[model samples]
Every structure is written in C-alpha cells, then in structure tokens.
Target: MNEQYPVLPGAEPFYAENGPAGVLLVHGFTGTPHSMRPLAEAYAKAGYTVCLPRLKGHGTHYEDMERTTFRDWIDSVEEGYEWLKERCGTIFVTGLSMGGTLTLYMAERYPSIRGIVLINPAIDIPAIRAGLAAGDELPRYLDSIGSDLKNPDVKELAYEKTPTASLLQLARLMEQVKGELERVACPILIFVSNEDHVVPPENADIIFRGVRSSDKEIVRLKNSYHVATLDHDQPLVIERSLRFFAKHSK
Candidate 1:
C-alpha cells in the first residue's frame, strides 16, 4: 500500500516503558494511533509498558486501506502483543471500535492475555450488511464515520472515506468473533455509548451475554457517541480502566 497521504504528527505509533505489566493499545478501522493516544499515555504515566501500533492500511491515504484485509490489521496487533510479551510480566489488551473487536479476538486466541478493555466494540454493524447487499454495485468507498465524539471540540484522526473491501472483511471477522466469545476467559471491561451512531448499543448486550468471562463488566456512556475514547466522557474510560486493571491484573 502506498502512503498517498502523509501520516499525521501525533497519529504515529506510541510506545513507552514503565512497569513490568504491558498494555497493548489498538486503534480502530481507518483510525490512527491518535484516537488511542490519550488512554495509552494514561497507562504509560501509571507506570505500565504501553505499545500502540498503527494498524495496517490505517493512518495513511484512503486508497491504501483498500489494499489491506482484516487479517493484516490483526497481524499488526499480534506483532505488538508479542513484543510486549517478551518484556512484560503480565499483558493486557484494550481497543476501540474495530480495535475492540481485535482485542476480543486476541483474548480468545491468546490465553496469556490477562485482561481486556473494549470501547464500543464493533461485533455487528448493519452498514456492513447493506454494503454487502449492494455488492459490486456499491462504490469503492463511503463517507467518513470518524469524530463521532459528544464533545464537539474533539476529533478523531481517521480516514475521510471508508474502504468498502476493508469494511466487508471487518464484517466477516466480526461474524467469526461473535461466535467465539466463550473463548475469552479473561476479565473484560466494556464501555459502550448509549447514543453510538456507528455501532448499535445492543452489540454490547450481545457481547456481555456471549462472553464466558465471569469478571466481565459493561459500563454505559450516557453522554458520548461511538468514539467514546475521545468524547466528553473520555476521562471515565481512562479512570475506570485503570481501576479495572488494578483489580484484575494482579
């Protein structure tokens, strides 16, 4: 994939060393590390080793995203997770949107994951089905779904156009993931926005019901939108996540 557009300044991957416990932060589809930076920094400051890797085809031009598949994104996260595993005593995974979906998949596959935090995880989206129904008749890309923050001032560094192929792959991956929730035996903390524009709030219920984790917790965001990590209630996401980690990642 060609880098038609230059990567944004703060959107680059972020890493910091601190405590023995490692935290892997993953960004969503079409999003850069910028969206997850605040939480990563918070974890870093709290004395945890944090690694935020830019997903393949993301943080670059929209055209390049079409060249990638869902596996590519997951591969990126897996690589970062392996890097953290070597250095950290315990590893926790957290992500937003598609990132959250990937986090769940990782937890299911990697029993080594100590815990996970998900923000508006995209287990299902009607738009993906609609695009699939349209098939080849649909355009190569669609309008942006970024910056769905309740706080008007905050904006996510995401693609202006959504890649159709990538979205299709995302849907397929979610279908596979939703069925394997029982495999996620680790502690999980999920934050969902009641007014999410992109992911239906009921997706959270589906996940809560599906996951076998006895320590699973779901926190609803009354004032935020889809991108709750960068919204008005962002601090709550960070604060609650820290507490959850402390409680479960011992």
Candidate 2:
C-alpha cells in the first residue's frame, strides 16, 4: 500500500543553529516543514537556533498520511522540542494550522516554553466534524487544503489531496486540545486571517477566549488567508513574533 505521490523539492525538515534561544517551527497536516522554512531561516539569522521537523506522516504521500494519527504528529513535535532543548537555554514555539494545534498541545504539556506564536491554529472547525460524521461514506481523500494563501504567486508544498481518516483523527485532536486550553498559560501571540477558507475565523476567538494565559494577544491578518506564514502578512507575523519572544525571553 505504498502509493507514490510527487514529493516536492525543498519540502523537507530544516534546522539551523546560531544562538542559545531555540525556536521550534511546526507545519500543518499534509504540510512539509518547507512551509515554515522562510520563518525558520529568519529566526536563525536573528541569532536563534531553529528546528523544523517533518511531522510523522506529512511531507510524503497522502497514503502515508492516512496511516498517521494525531498522537504520531505530536510525537514529532516533542522530538523536535527535545532536540532544541539540548542546544539552547530558552525556547519558543510557533506553528500554522494543525501545527499550531500541536504547538498549543506542547505549550500545555511542557511548561518550559518561553513563548508561543500560532498562525491560524485549528481547534474546532465545523468542516472537520462534518467530514468525520460523514466518515467512510466519503472518498478516501478530498481536495487539497494547500495553497490557501491570498498571494496567488505563492504556493504551499503540500499534498494535493486530503486524507479522510487523518481528518477524523485531527478532529479528535482539536476537541482534546480545546478541553485543555486552560493548561496553556505561556505568553502567546496568535495570527488569524479574516478571510481564511480552510479554517473558520471563529477558531481564533475560541482560542483567545479559552486560554488562561495572562499575556496573550491576537492579530487579525487583513491581507492573508489560512496559510499566513507564506502570505502577504508574513513580515508582520515574523516581526511581531520576534518582539513577543524578546519581550518574554529570560
């Protein structure tokens, strides 16, 4: 059952070391670390150790993704965190979409996170539950969730199709994370696109209202869509995140 899919060049895990401040970048479901490469490079150049690991079933074929569970995805983030912990004195985490979900999960599970930044982090999207309810009635896969950027020239290197089983698992994960949002007390910065097609904008409100963090702010992206990491507001995300990290750094 090794179905082959086109693996895009440069769509692989990335890492760099420059200083004691470590930053972990996590990509979304069906997405490769390539989506976060520019951000990672920016952080590295700014004198921070950056680690972006390809999540368990992502950056490969859709068939491989179908075989992965949410636990497997989070495990990859944990591994990346451990790797960064070994090289730096302080750590920050940021993610996009499902990556953001894992970032919140990590922030709650590990109190060592100095700060948190999330771009369109998925929590309880209605489509996810709808798709899960439909279950096996739907095809093994659906249209790709990639390339949600409003900048038509920019394309995300992600699967062309979405796996149904994995989507169900993701729905479950979202529910679980929402329940534990109170545990995420780290300083947080969140970016939400007002015109996102893949994830509803309300998800951001849910997070902002649920988290118990004393220092948390939400920035609405006026020009970008779901994949704001590679969109027009990318600079804003990077700049604000760097500031947030610096403000909370030890």
Candidate 3:
C-alpha cells in the first residue's frame, strides 16, 4: 500500500529507510504484505531498513491472481531484494509459507545474503503435487487457506478463494526450490508449527535436512498454527529472528 501501486486497505507494501543493513520480508501465496507487516515493522523498529513487498496478483483480489504465475511472484521478491541490495551492505531475507520458499530461492542465487528467517515455509505439499499430477481440469477457484492462526481473534487478510492454477505454480516452485536447497548456504532460522493444518510440519524437517547452511536452527511453534507470525508465538518469532539477524548481520 505504498506509493508504488494500488492495493487493498492494509495490504500496501511498506518500506522503511533506516540503515545500511536491511531486511526484506516476503508474504505467502494468495496473501498480501499485510501478513508480514508486523514483522516488517519490527525490523524497522530495530533501525534496519525493511521492505515488505506485496507479491504480484495478491493484496487485491483472488481473480487478479489468475493472470499471474510463481515467476511473477518471484519477480516481486527479487525487486525487493534488489532494493535492499542497492542500499544495504548487509541484507537479510525472511518469509512466511511460499514467501519462505522465495527467501530460500534468494539465498540460493545470492550467496552474499547475510542470513534468513522462515516461518512455515512450504516446500513440498503432497496434495498440491498430486493435483498437479492428475492433469485434470481443475476448478477455477477453491476454498481459502488463509487465516490459519491459532488465535481466534486475529485473522489474516488472505484471499477468500484460491485460484486453482496457482497451486500448480506453487508445486512447480517447490520442486524448483527443493532441488537447490543444497545451494542455500546462508545462516537460517526456521520456524515450524507443530500443529499446522496447511503445510505439513514435515516441511521443516525437509528444509533442515536439505539446506547446505551449516548454521541452521529449527524451532517448533507449539502454540501456533500455519501463520505463526500472527499467532500466539509471534513475540517469540520476532525476538528470535532479531537475534538471528543481529548474530549474522555483524
């Protein structure tokens, strides 16, 4: 919701001009930057320049997502990373769900990334893979997968209906990302929800085992669900991430 483009209320991408050290926060598929806004603000508060970009085809409407692909979403993240790289000598990347996937993608390509943080990164979802394997004509829209927060009071500003074709791209992205996990050598701090209903908890294990980052830690979120960033353990997530960034950014 910044000056770059129009977005729904609370969905605008935000940038904080703070320092030579920056953090780029990416949101998940079918999700707007609102999901990652809290974390972005947290990073900004710590005097780190922060960019939380609204992925293409998101933060507007589900129908808009139909015209997009995973590559488009990736391009959005790359743009944000470039913004940070231009201004910040030390850059860190962090994401949630597919955002985390993109974060890993960034590390795979840019070995200069100081560190990374992931919340419920979705690498391999079996149901999505099977659906792609079927090759059957899929419905144009399906039930929403957003707002999977453990706290009933808070809700994620995600799409109400998921574009079916996007799932295929997600599967493709996962395949592409998981194959290059060994190339992600940046220090990583991963958060996994123990009771997530969206992406399986096994994803954490896969990432932990797959990433070549000798400096990696996986913390289980027992008090949260899929969107742990807005869940009960959010404070913990923010605190741990700040510590991780500080440790590596130095």
Assess each prediction's global lDDT (C-alpha) against the native. 0.90, 0.90, 0.91
Clash number by candidate, in order = 0, 0, 2
lDDT of 1 by residue, 72-168 (tens): 8888999999889888989999999999999999999999899999999999888788879888898888899898888988888999999888888
Considering every candidate listed, which one attains the maximal TM-score? 1
Residues 1-250, model 2: lDDT tens digits: 3326555577778899878999999999888988899899889888889999988888878888998889899889999999999999899999999999999999999998988999999998987787678756898888999989899899999999999888888998999999999999999999999999998989988999999899999999999998999999999999999988788886
For candidate 1, report its TM-score.
0.97
Candidate 3 positional error at 225, Å? 0.2
What's the TM-score of each model vs. the native?
0.97, 0.96, 0.96
Alpha-carbon error at 15 in model 2, in Å? Answer: 0.7
Model 2 residue 85 lDDT score: 96
Error of 1 at 155 (Å): 1.3
